[model samples]
Target: MTRRTVRIAMNGVTGRMGYRQHLVRSILAIREQGGLDLGDGEVVWPEPVLVGRRAHALEELAERHGLTEWSTDLDAVLADDSVEIYFDAQVTSARVEAIKKAIAAGKHVYTEKPTATDVEGALDLARLARDAGIKHGVVQDKIFLPGLRKLKRLIDGGFFGEILSVRGEFGYWVFEGDWQAAQRPSWNYRAEDGGGIVVDMFPHWEYVLHELFGQVTSVTAHVRTHVPQRWDEQGKPYEATADDAAYGIFELAGGAVAQINSSWTVRVNRDELVEFQVDGTHGSAVAGLRNCRVQHRSSTPKPVWNPDLPVTESFRDQWQEIPDNQEFDNGFKAQWELFLRHVVQGAPYTWDLLAGARGVQLAELGLKSSAEGRRFDIPELTL
Candidate 1:
């Protein structure tokens, strides 16, 4: 077997998502599995060069993971001829410039989304990557999740005669850093720092709804900063300049409506941190991060509207659980594998920089809709 190494310059491994999901779960896990097999006597191994702002953190992470290469100077790492790919999990504000540098260096690029703070920036990146002839992609991990995969199966099998609507609830109470340490970084609450629920989660909703359902033709949103004063990582009080919650309604191309609520102030009473209930003419399904349940119209029980009487029906028990018929890998890791295959084998991959630009465009439009108190029609994007 021919074993080939593809060196990847991974920027911003010190962050939470960067460290836990991208580095440990995805890249490192792939390495542990003895590289990805491209078949035909060829195997592609990932050689990650940790790149970040803090030398100590990068060094510590590299040492902890038994990785040999670590560099604080991104320029130096990018200059390395062996580094074939550049992956970014940096803060949203820092991502654009870093990715630009990577593309200019003639490296294939992949990164976490919203690819840029605004639509124009995201489109610029897409154009740059296309013109440079470098393959690029964005992390659309949700589509690979087990629960959503089940939902997709149902959709493909024509279980839903006519999909009508989708409702999504995502979020948990992020503790004020004063009483308990905030689970999210402090920058997530600052607008100037490119932090907000709309900026953070709308891109996710856009991709999820678009991929599984239809194109988002229009959007109407209401956004708010539910928690005004919160403490930072340093335990210092700071005004939360960004909206922590967003209520949005997206109109899909095929007339399906998606209503999603993203909030950091809400308490979880559901099965998962995030869940989507999709209702159709023939059936309905509720999918969370790991579980999916469905109910067919034929099996649905009819209950009389009795506001004056106590409810006796077990509403939750009516749904049937979808069995996991096959083994499921971590969503992030699965996408990573796909991206790696696309890079190594010249496989057809649709989730490119242009797809990433659409996500950013959705987020940007969501914010605009909220601010102007009106719905905005989405414009088609091209690179």
Candidate 2:
């Protein structure tokens, strides 16, 4: 078998999402599986060099993972010819510049999105990547989610015939850290630090909506900062300038309205931390992060309202569970595999920098709509 090693520079993997999702669950998992099979007696293995600021932490991580290389010298790593891909999972405020540096250094670039804080920066990055003639991609892990995959399958089989509306509820209570420790980092609440629910979550929504349903034609939003202040890592109280919660109404290309609620101040009362309930003429489906349940028009329950009387019908049990017909990998890993295949075999890779820019555009417009107190039309991005 022809085995090829693709050297990659992994940046900011010390962070939670970067470490858990991108590094440990994805690239390392791929390495453990003997790399990616090309189906022609060839395999492409990934060789990653961990790059972060803290040398001691990086050394610890590298030694624990049995990684041979770790570096704080990003410029030196980027200058190396052996490194083919530059992957960034840094704070959003730090991403665009690092990505630009990678592109300029003649490396293929892949990064977490929203690629930039604003629409202009995102688009500019897309244009620069295009001009550099390097392959670029943004993380859209939701599309590869097993639950969403099943929903896509149903949509493909015409199960969701004439889809009417989609309602997505995504969020959980993020403790203020007054008593119990907060689950999320405090940086997530600061606007200057590239934090906010609208910026963080809307990117995922944009890709999910664009890939599964349709393009977002317009958006109306109401945003708020429920907790104005929160304690930081050093136990210092700080002001949170960003919106902690965002309620949005989106008009899709095909006349479907999507209502999405994202917040850190709310408690979840659903089967999953995040769930999307889709309604269509022929059938309806509710998909969580890992499971999907559907109710066909023919098998849908008929229940009459009886608020005064005791409940008789089990409404929750009416939906049929979608079976796992095949083995599914971690969502982030799945997308990484696709991207690797695209890099190695010239496979179809459409989730480019432009797609990422659209996500940032949506977030920007949503914030603008919230500020202006009116709906804003989202014209199709041209780059």
Candidate 3:
């Protein structure tokens, strides 16, 4: 068997998502598994070169993981001819310039979203990547989640016959950084720092809605800053300039409507932090991060509502659980494997920079809809 080593420059390893999910769970996990087996007696091995702003943190992380390559100088790393791919998990404000440099360096690129802070910047990145003739992708991890995958399976098997509508609830309380330090970085609540619920999450909704149900045709949103003030990492107070919550109604192409409520101020009451309830003519399903329960038309219980009497039926008990027929891997790891195959073996990868741009477009339109207090039609995007 022949083994091919692909060198990837992974920037932003010092950050939260960068350190935990991408670096540890995804890339290193692949290496621990003895590389990805491509069948046909070929194995693709990944070599990650950690890049970040903090030299100390990078050094420490490299030492802990026994990874040799670590760099604070992005230019020097990009200059290396051996580095075939550049991955970015940097702050939203810094992603564009770095990716632009990577494209100029003629390296394949992968990044977290919003690929840019705005639609124009996102589209520019797409155009540049296309012109550079480099393979590129953005993280759309939600689609790979077990619950969503099973939901997709049901949809494919025509379980939800003539899909009607979808309702999604996603969020939990984020500490205000006073008595308890905020779970999220203080920058997430600041508009100047490319933070806000709309910017942070609407991209995810765009892809999830598009992939599972249909293309989003229109959006109407109510955006708010529920927590007006919050403390920073240093325990200092600052005005929260960004919207903390957003209630949105998205109209899909197939006449199906989706209402998703995203908030950082709300308390959790559902079985999962994020859940989607999809209703159709034949069956209905409630899918969370790891579990999915369904109630079909034939076996669905009929409940009678009366103000005079207390409820007797357990509504939750009416649904049946979907069994996991196969093992599931981390969503981030799954996508990384796919991107590796796409890079080395010329495999088909449809989620490109253009698709990421479309997501940015959705967030932009959503914010505009909230500001204008009217619904906006989602225009088709092009390279």
Candidate 1, residue 250: the lDDT equals: 98
Scored by lDDT, model 1 comes in at 0.94
User: In model 3, which runs have C-alpha deviations exceeding 4 angstroms?
Assistant: none
Q: Could you estimate the TM-score for every candidate?
A: 0.99, 0.99, 0.99
lDDT of 3 at 166: 98
Model 2 lDDT per residue over 310-370, tens place: 9987888999999989998999998888888888888999999999999999999999999
Model 3 scores a C-alpha lDDT of 0.95
The digit string of per-residue lDDT tens for model 1 on 1-383 reads: 99999999999889999999999999999999998888779888999999998999988898898999999899999999899999999999999999999999999999999899999999999999999999999999999999999999999999988999999999999999998999999999999999999989998988899899999999999999999999998999999999999999999999999999999999999999999999999999999998999999999899899899999889999999999999999999999889999989889899999999998999999999988999999999986
Give the poorly placed runs of model 2, Cα more than 4 Å off.
Answer: none
RMSD in Å for all candidates: 0.7, 0.9, 0.6
Compute the lDDT for candidate 2: 0.93
For model 3, name the residue pairs that clash. Answer: none
Scored by CA lDDT, what does every candidate get?
A: 0.94, 0.93, 0.95
Of models 1 and 2, which has the larger TM-score?
1
